[model samples]
Target chain A: MARQPLRKVGSTWKPPGKPAGQAQAQDPAGSKGEAALVAGLRAGDAKAFEEVVLRYGPRLLIVGRRILGNEEDARDCVQETFLATHRSIGEFQGRSNLGTWLRRIVTNAALMKLRARRTRPEESIEEFLPKYDPNLFRGGPRNANALTPEELLQRADTRKLVQEAIDRIPGSYRTVLLLRDFEGYSTQETAQLLDTTDGAIKVRLHRARTAMKELLAPLFDEELR
Target chain B: MREFLLKLLLQFRGDKDPGPTEQRVGSWMLRHLPGMLTCPEFEEFIHDYYEGLLSAKVRRRFETHMQLCPMCQVHFDSYVRAIALGRQVCSDDEQLPEGMPQELVAAILLARNQDLDS
Candidate 1:
């Protein structure tokens, strides 16, 4: 009669709060009740659709905004992601966590929106990349006075600066950085998604990171003096 | 390669305690190893090394360069630190997306309903 504490629904683990009496941990489908949920989804149960939207919407919205870079586009992307998921659930095999699957859908939807919204040529990332020197240590490779992740949480200005810097990086390179670093894709996966070579992806990722470092230079400055 | 570079580092940087004999050997490697990386070359490989994408031969060369060149060490360490910081910023950024607005959810459900009817 013990209630399970947590369940992995799609890609994320959350407490099985609303769907009472589900036993977790032993079930590989992540949630003991997930099969029924999937069944309802397949059957076009309106409530099933609502439950999933409530569960994964926020995370997916983040993915949307991060990639699409605006409120209106992000909201539109989330809607399309759910509609796409609903249409494609029968084909999803349930091999991966539903959350993981949904995240991918959201990411793709955002990227497609991004491609459509390429109104002007991408801005140059040269100013954002590190200032390399041909001679020696790029001004003696300054000290790593880096902030801790917890420290980053307390620093709103740094976070805002980072957001601004990301907006500055060119689309091609920024997409690579987000996929490889934040979205946790491998170089190969990123290359495949972007239709490029692994070497190309690696180079772009490096440039992206270096550009980010340059942009956030105020926080983590090089030892130029 | 590693031993050779460590010797070279000890000699050029005058690391104080290198024995008389080791100093001679480091001096020898410095002259013999024509293919050793220059500082500029090391700069190119810093990010590659961080990503763990360098080949074994290249990695040995990369490590040797880092050890031998104090400036490059500072440079590489700085770059690596910035990368770690970038990841942290990203982790925090991920928090920005959680707690999706309820209107969006209702909108999704409503859209799904319309799709079903159509």
Candidate 2:
């Protein structure tokens, strides 16, 4: 059967108009196209391989950069991901979309790089949590309404500050945060990728969030002032 | 309200009047208020609270606690900001510094072809 070309959807591979609840009802044509592409990749068709690279390279690079925190390392990880994918194409079950499978590969590659590059001891997140007084409240009651995160996020500088704060979190907690929160991976997926339990992912996510908030509290406080 | 009395007492104690920012921060601290949840209790339920997984009774309790607790409110706000930052950084619209590098493609294809030949 002649295969249709995979539609170049948006920058990411999300179905354009389908709501998230309809994820189980994938577009038949799109699925057929991806199945054909997978077959071609398995057969070592050069065109199919090139198409995958061109389509997914930028997106994977962004994932690498965010997790690895630098262009050089990110590029290396993306390249490694492609190489790994090419070698392991036969093992890819059709359970997930090709893009999602590739994302998982890229995440793994980036996380490996991150682990190798880490030399510092992990830091405790306790200091980042809010300290309570005898009354169990840090600050007394008042009438000022701090801006919502959505409001602060509208400012480009605030976005940059938030990004910087994310970067400062220790790698152990940071990776869990990135995979679960940033990459939108489920706790189960993140746990599998990181080789931990879902319970651990939940704990780390909470601590990571608390630490992140601590890092940004000063900036938010400044904005409120 | 008890909070109003506390503010009055601070003034009588010859403490400088609380600044607008301090007052604002203080307003969130509902610890002395009835139905207030302690910080530890808030932390225990916060994730479930955010995810909307808590039962209605628990959710109501959590909301009541947030209403009375300034510190938990701040904690929740910061938690939200952290998630937002991650989303923004990882957003698909984030442009690569330089478009995809040609050398990367060339290298991958070369490596793959070499593997094929072998």
Candidate 3:
């Protein structure tokens, strides 16, 4: 007997539950819309490509700005991100959320830009970290008093100060701090994004947090008094 | 005799005490402080402690040490504040800068369309 070719059950393949285009049209940035967006991109649908850029372009630029710290470089990074995503859309396995995948791409692009621009010798993080005595007791200025109501009222300014302090840290630690603390990426995710070990991520995160505290100590101590 | 009189007058005026010079670690805390973990050791575990990754035994010891060591406590508090501030700054979506550049969008679309054609 001659063998007969078997036909697949469904003519059209879609992600489990709900058509992607409809869901995405209702809420473009939501995860439900991601499948349809991915499908459209895979199919080379011009409208899908336009929608992806229109929806995520501004947010991705913000991410790039945070990492690169310059408007022009950030813009360049985001541009590269969209182009790279377009070229590599076929390789996107949908293992992570679309936003996360895009974020990882932008982070890598910004880091590359930063690396290319690092012509001078980088400064040591020690200067920004807290000093400890021989016994390992922190020896910097102390503030035993908690934040008062008046001090708490300056939270907005404090946030800006914190962002400034973050910008001052060395790029290596700064990236880790931004990804882990600012972006709320898990240690594992940050490590994967940076192509480093989990242990390295944890160590850098600890040092970065400690350095940030040291940098902000003067401001906080003044408020305490 | 003059010094004694001044001290007595200050006491009577309720100004002799310098007030509490910040909260010192109580004697009870000192008695319970971990003898094994030094400041450096405790410092190394701070990240794990904050992330809730420390084992129960280590966490107990770290907490005990924190109770007795005002310096470490202050460091820990500052670390917490730093994390909180970072989160606060990051979460304030209002601080997001202006929208994406128009030219960049056009460039991306052009590149993507060219790729599709090829």
Candidate 4:
């Protein structure tokens, strides 16, 4: 007869009344709250996971939309991102801000999705073209004397032009610019998210900005003069 | 004062590389061009004067320079194009290619969660 395995159920599992992670503890002493929550999560406390989702859901949504270029996909990415984050909570090495680590995961997920759905083959030359020519403006002095707001809206179509320029950038460069310029991530933050060095992010961002400058030249030719 | 200003302007002069001046201007332009150039108010009257957005008095003076200045014209045109293109590329309304289905989001999440549990 083999010895019966010890059935120490009550000790290994959390108390029935305790909130699933470190969150139920006192107000976090500095970073201790997050640390506690992470610990609870490691212990399989479900509530700790919920707190993580609540904290990051909105920020991640914006990131997803910018990366994926659509609202619905962004929302989907957030949900999946949190779930994945939850699964890997045990292995989280605590070497980074949880937000940064989670963001890295979300960014990778978004990139993977883009890669999977993209129709173009990897490394195709045609993917590098400026998506639209910036010469859409009719050549002529815009009638400046027309002072009405409606007239300006009709003639300028400023919003549409901006979108077209963004569309024209190559994929990697485009994502870098979007993260830096639109989403307001720092060079270091973006580097972490993309899993690249800060030097690489800087180089890519410079190229993106230069490309953006070319696209915008026609619009501002008059202003700079 | 006018003589000093002219000397300063000469360092940014269109005919030559202006070397360091161009780099400074490039950095300044990168940050501010988006806001400064997008106004239709400036775009409408840009062609009447070579330096489209300069004050009338300033434009009157630059006009004389531009008459013989091909470099200024080309550089100015390139800047204009860049601002216009920047606005277009970053605009929000641009459509995305079709995305993963809602079901896929669920499937992926569920699969990941299950893996964690196991």
Candidate 5:
């Protein structure tokens, strides 16, 4: 018999009967509640699996969107993450938090999607990176102004501005910045995930960050005055 | 300080020139000797400095340059802010539950169920 598809539950539909705030209990790895949920998942409990989806799906989707930047690709990768998790549930050792584990899957899925979707050679980000005079101490003039990102925190458009600047970065470095800075992956982890060496990741990450600094100069300078 | 380090380098290469300052190089008082790093030089080390990969002696020089050189200070501050902004907007766990399309969830379950049944 073919399994039935789920009916539309509207936007307010949560996992079975659990309230919203307590849903975190179902998601955090290694917690007793989550461990039991893991057991149910391993036991092939359909409801338990649905609970996991409803709890973690949105965040994973957000991660996918941030990583892949295309709606269809992001959604497809996120869906694949859930399927992968289901297949591999019994093998999870709980060393990493469950959320972290799922995120890793989603990120990898998105990266694979990106590889498949690559249309052209990646652009060089050298022009975007910070440039200083080749000589020492003569790096232009001393500006009395020091602009910090902390000052932009209260702005309503800060996130939008930052996102737009990030969108402008070439893929090669932008991916590194997102993985190292945003995804909280260490250099070694990012290197391993991206199939690159740690030294390569470090160089790309620094260049990416330097480029971002150059790209966001307007906003930072706006706060400076 | 440049002359002091220069003379020390000369001595290490086995060139014989006695200097009181080269002896002063290893003294506890000279431990904080700030290197004369130009703005461009400091820029190169910013990544290493942030990663805590620089030796204490080098870090003192980096910090000293940053404090005394406002240009490098601005550059370094902006670099730090750029990372903060990127992280701010890309936080992994920022979930808007209401924003998740219910249809996606429906599709995922449908696909999973079909996978197992087959």
Candidate 6:
């Protein structure tokens, strides 16, 4: 198979020595798999419950982290998610993938905790992207008036700018963006985890990236100007 | 290109197992060089829109903004590719548990085979 290129934007794709250890697409558990697990749990098969728990544990942790914001709270959220999952197995009805169902339970648990603590929504959607003003940096692409090495170094400092911008974003936008963008959750999965619609996930993601860009305006000023 | 870099940095900031959020975001942005050459407006929308968080109206506005912005479209594409690559990296590194949960597997099998009458 032709290796996928890790091309930079505006550049044609080129094959780099393939980097290793990529995660696979998340496959929802089949009905048969769910049925088996449900049967085992219903039959008081302790081992079966353990299997389900093990399979879904890390994902549960990731979802919990987004909502709870700390590993300790996230761990508690995972436990609660499983406990609820076990209690509700008989009633699962196989309507959704087991992982989706579990994620729903975990998200609800974390949201409830967030609500109880009155965790404030951190940044508005517009504020999530990094900030830059185009009028200030209106030089055309061919202009080479400002390429001194030291000044160029400042323009190169993109990572720092991007980081600071993310730091400024509201926690709600951060969570959704991280889950969808960083953690590789599908819009549907994110919606399930966030208890929102897929349309909502797309909007949050778009806004979050835009806000991040705004936050990093200084980084762009040197390069674009 | 500028938008693409931001999207990559935004979504995959932590996946490199970067020690901190700051480090992750910084490292990712630095890695994608020269792409920032283009001045992109979608970048502004990305950061500004997020400050408002999750109001229903903001969601609508964000969508509307994307529909109108060409730069954001390119950024969105890069963001998606970066995500796919990150997942690939994570998947290859993960170590599966030694065996399938035997009890869980058995339970699922039993459930599938079970007849209410039996």
Candidate 1 CAPRI level? acceptable
Candidate 2 DockQ score?
0.24
Which is the leading candidate under TM-score? 5
Error at A58, model 5, angstroms: 0.9
The residue-by-residue lDDT of candidate 1 on A171-191, one tens digit each, is: 989898887777776678778
> Taking the candidates in order, what DockQ does each have?
0.24, 0.24, 0.22, 0.09, 0.26, 0.06
TM-score for each of the candidates: 0.77, 0.76, 0.76, 0.47, 0.78, 0.48
What DockQ would you assign to candidate 4? 0.09
User: Which digits, one per residue and each the tens of the lDDT, describe model 2 over residues B32-115?
Assistant: 556556767778776666565678777666665554444565566556656665565556344444467899889888888888
After superposition, candidate 2 runs with Cα above 4 Å error: A1-33, A139-150, A222-225, B1-36, B92-98
Model 3 C-alpha lDDT per residue in residues A94-164, reported as the tens digit of each score: 87767667877888899889889889987788886566675456575333446632364375567667778
Q: In candidate 4, what are the lDDT values of residues B3-118, reduced to their tens digit?
A: 34444554445444334454354334422433222222222333333222357564534432322222333333443344333433333222234444446445554655686679
Q: Which is superior by DockQ, 5 or 6?
A: 5
Model 5 Cα lDDT, one tens digit per residue, A42-128: 998999998888877777888788878888988998889989988999888888667777888898999888778788998888787
> Which candidate do you rate higher for DockQ, 4 or 5?
5
Q: What's the DockQ of model 3?
A: 0.22
The true-versus-predicted C-alpha distance at residue A35 of model 5, in Å, is 0.6
The interface root-mean-square deviations, each candidate in sequence, come to 14.3, 14.8, 20.6, 27.3, 19.8, 13.2
For candidate 3, list the clashing residue pairs, or say none. none
The per-residue C-alpha lDDT of model 5 at residue B27 equals: 30
lDDT of 6 by residue, A52-104 (tens): 87777666666566556677777777776776666667777756667766766
Worst window of 10 by summed lDDT in candidate 6 chain B: B64-73
| Steric clash pairs (candidate 1) | A10-A97, A10-A98, A10-A99, A11-A99, A11-A100, A142-A223
DockQ of 5: 0.26
RMSD of each: 10.9, 11.4, 16.7, 20.5, 15.1, 14.4
What candidate 6 gets wrong by more than 4 Å, as runs, is: A1-35, A124-168, A182-201, A212-225, B1-118
**Residues B28-110, candidate 6, lDDT per residue (tens digit)?**
34334432322344343443333333355544434433322323433443333333333333333244343333453444344
